[model samples]
Target: MATYIIGDIHGCYDELQSLLTQAQFNQNTDELWFTGDLITRGPKSLETLRFIKGLGDTAKIVLGNHDLHLLSINEGIFPNHKKDNLTPIFEAPDCNTLLTWLRFQPLMRRHPAFKFALVHAGVYPRWSLKKAEKLAKEIEVQLQSENYKQLLIDMYGGAPCSWSNNLTGIKRMRFIINAFTRMRYCLPDGSLDFKNKLSPEQTNNANLTPWYEAITLKPNRSILFGHWASLMGKVNKSNIYGLDTGCVWGNSLTMLRWEDKKYFSVPSTIK
Candidate 1:
């Protein structure tokens, strides 16, 4: 049973199915790990959510920023943007069920046998594996609780930019959310930059570095992440994988077969 880790799907259900066909994915045997952003910006958000949710234990996921934004929109904290392509999800009969499942998903996951740590984005440069895991759990508890709406409402923004163990309340949660979901380029001092979206080669600022470049993970600890579509799966760092191939932008959807480390991709069929 090979474990297949897919890149940012972003509602491209047809491509997702075709990639699964290309990979020979066996729902009853093979495991599927999603790098998240499962909805938004593609053609079939509802189909994507329903299909993945139906997978049950066969699927593993870490929620992306778009997934969280969908929850916020459900709670009336944010307006639905025309560009997000989330109307199909909202119009679905199982919308609440899908969103609730999404809300319960962890911000981080570690596969013991594969030695891969998964997050929608990169880990903060300042956090150790244990600290990052703890912080992720901290927010997860609040998110799953009855007060989750309040937590969601407060989790927006770029604040407390630097990590401090002393940080408390909403500021602490927000920092964890950004690092796990929205992080891309970071300043030299290990603070999140939040600005530039260019590929590393295209960026003019010499001080800015991709989050993976700024940190040295423990030996044999590989990090698998998506959400940086501009990267197009071209990170030169060892044991660090960027799987988002910009499928929502009419590029290919990429996946990694962990055991043999083979990659399979399917060109987007969406227009």
Candidate 2:
């Protein structure tokens, strides 16, 4: 039995299927882990949602920023953008069921036996593994609770850039959500920067650093994440893996086999 972790899918369901075939994934035996952004910006948001949800016990997904935005729009907390292609999902007969399943999905997951953790984006540099787990669970509880609508309404923004023990209420939740889903570059002191999308070498800002570069994770701890497709699956570290290859942006969909560390990809059908 193998376990495969795939990068940001966006809405490229065709590429997702091709990548699965390339990996020779067995739905009966192998498991699939998704780094989220499962829908948006591409043509097949509804198909992608339905296919992944159909995987049932074989699929594990962490919510990316786009995923949250989709939820926000679905719940009427946010407006659909002009470039957005998520109308199909909203118009589907199973839209309510799909969104409910998505709302309950966690922001982070840890393999019970493996030495790695999975998140949509990088973890806070100041947060230890235990602390990260606890904090992630906090948001998961709020999202799955009856107050989730209000939580979604307050989930936007890039405020409270630095982590503070004193932060409370929606402020704290927003910070946690950003760090887990939308974060990319951060200041030296671990304050997240939502402005930069350029890669580490391409960036002109001297003070900005890739989030993984600033992480101070303990030994034996590794993370598999997506989010920043601009990195193009490059982190220059063994423990940190960036799987988002920008498939929806006309790049390839990438995946890594956790057990043997094999990589597989398929070119995007769009563009």
Candidate 3:
């Protein structure tokens, strides 16, 4: 059985289907893993979510920043952005059911047999895989709890860029959420930079390092991530994979087949 790890979909359902076909995906045997951002800023968020949800056990996804934003908007913590055009989601018949499933999804996932792991944006540079998984689970538990709205309320912002075992409450949750779903560049001291979204080659700042570059992970730890379309899937490191290819921004959607490391892509069909 083959496992396919795909980059941020961003609601490009047509592209997703094409990519799957290009990869020769067999829904009965091949598993589809996503790096997140399944919806938002694309032409078919509702259709994308419905198709993946209908896949049931065949599909797995981590939560992305856009996905979290959808939850916050649903809970009235924030208003819908017209640019994102998420009204179709709220108007769907199984909207609440779809959201309930979305929120329960994890922030990081490790392939059960493979040495690789997946996160939306990145793992904290200083975090070990075990530590990262523990912290990710903390937010997942909060999201699964009845007080999820409060978790969403507290999860905004980029403060507490530095990590410490002493961090607690909202500060801790924010750090974990930002690192997993919104982070880009990181400082030498392992502090996160939320402002810089440019690719490493475009950045003139010598002190700023890509999170994967700054990471001290063991050589055995491989991570696949999305959320930075400007990267266009170029991290240049063998162990760290950047899968987001700006599919929602008129670029192509990309995915990698796990067994042979073959990539498949489909150009955007949005107009």
Candidate 4:
């Protein structure tokens, strides 16, 4: 049975199906790993959520910023924007079931045998694998708890950019959330720089570097992430994979098969 890791789906259900068809996905055997942002922006948020949720053990996922935003809006902590295409999901008859499943999803997942870790975005530069995993569990517990509304309420914002082990409460949780979900470029000192969204080579800021460029991961540890669509599956490093091909923006949806290290794509069906 093969495992395929898909990029940021962002509600592009048709393209998702196309990619799966292209890959000849076997739901009865093959496993699917989603890089997240499973909803919003595209035309079929409800369909996307329902389909993936139906996959059960055949699918694994890491939560993206958009996914968290959906939860926050559901809890009435954040306002949904007019341009956002989440109404279909919010109005779905099974919305509660879908959202609860999303909340329980982990921020990061590792496959020791594959020698890779999957996250929606990058890991914190200051965190070791063990520390990052433990911290991820802490927030995951909060997200799955009865107090999750409070977690959503406090999960917004960009602050305390630098990592410190002493960080406590919401600040700590927020930092972990940003690194695992919203991180892109980071300052030279290893602090998250939320302002830059350009491809690494295109960034004009002298002090900025893609988070991966400034950090050292464990030897032979590969990181598979999405959420930086600007990169378009390009990163100079061999061990780092950026799978988000901007499918929601009418680009291609991508997937990488881990065993053979091959990529497959399907052009967006929207527009």
lDDT, candidates in the order shown: 0.91, 0.90, 0.92, 0.90
Model 2 Cα lDDT, one tens digit per residue, 131-219 = 88899999999999998889989988889899998999999999999999988988977798998888887998999988788787667
The window of 10 residues in a row where model 4 has the poorest summed lDDT is: 210-219
Cα lDDT tens digits, model 4, 70-124, are 9988887878775778887778889899999999999999886887889999888
- For each candidate in turn, give its C-alpha RMSD to the true structure in angstroms: 0.9, 1.0, 0.9, 1.1
- Candidate order (TM-score): 3, 1, 2, 4
Candidate maximizing lDDT: 3
Better of 2 and 3 by lDDT: 3
Give model 4's TM-score versus the native structure. 0.97
Angstrom error of the Cα, residue 211, model 4: value is 0.8
Error of model 4, residue 39, in angstroms: 0.6
Judged by lDDT relative to the true structure, which candidate is superior, 1 or 2? Answer: 1
Query: Positional deviation of 87 in candidate 4, in angstroms?
Result: 1.2
Over 131-246, each residue of candidate 1 has an lDDT whose tens digit, in order, gives 88888999999999999999989988899788888989999889999999999988877788887788998898998989998878878889999999999999998799999999
Which lDDT tens digits does candidate 3 get at residues 46-131? Answer: 99999999999999899999999999999999988889968999999999999999999999999888878899999888889999
Colliding pairs, model 3: none
* Model 1 steric clash pairs: none
- Model 2 misses residue 167 by how many Å? 0.7
Error of 2 at 251 (Å): 0.8
Flag regions of model 1 displaced more than 4 Å.
none
Model 4 residue runs over 4 Å out of place are none
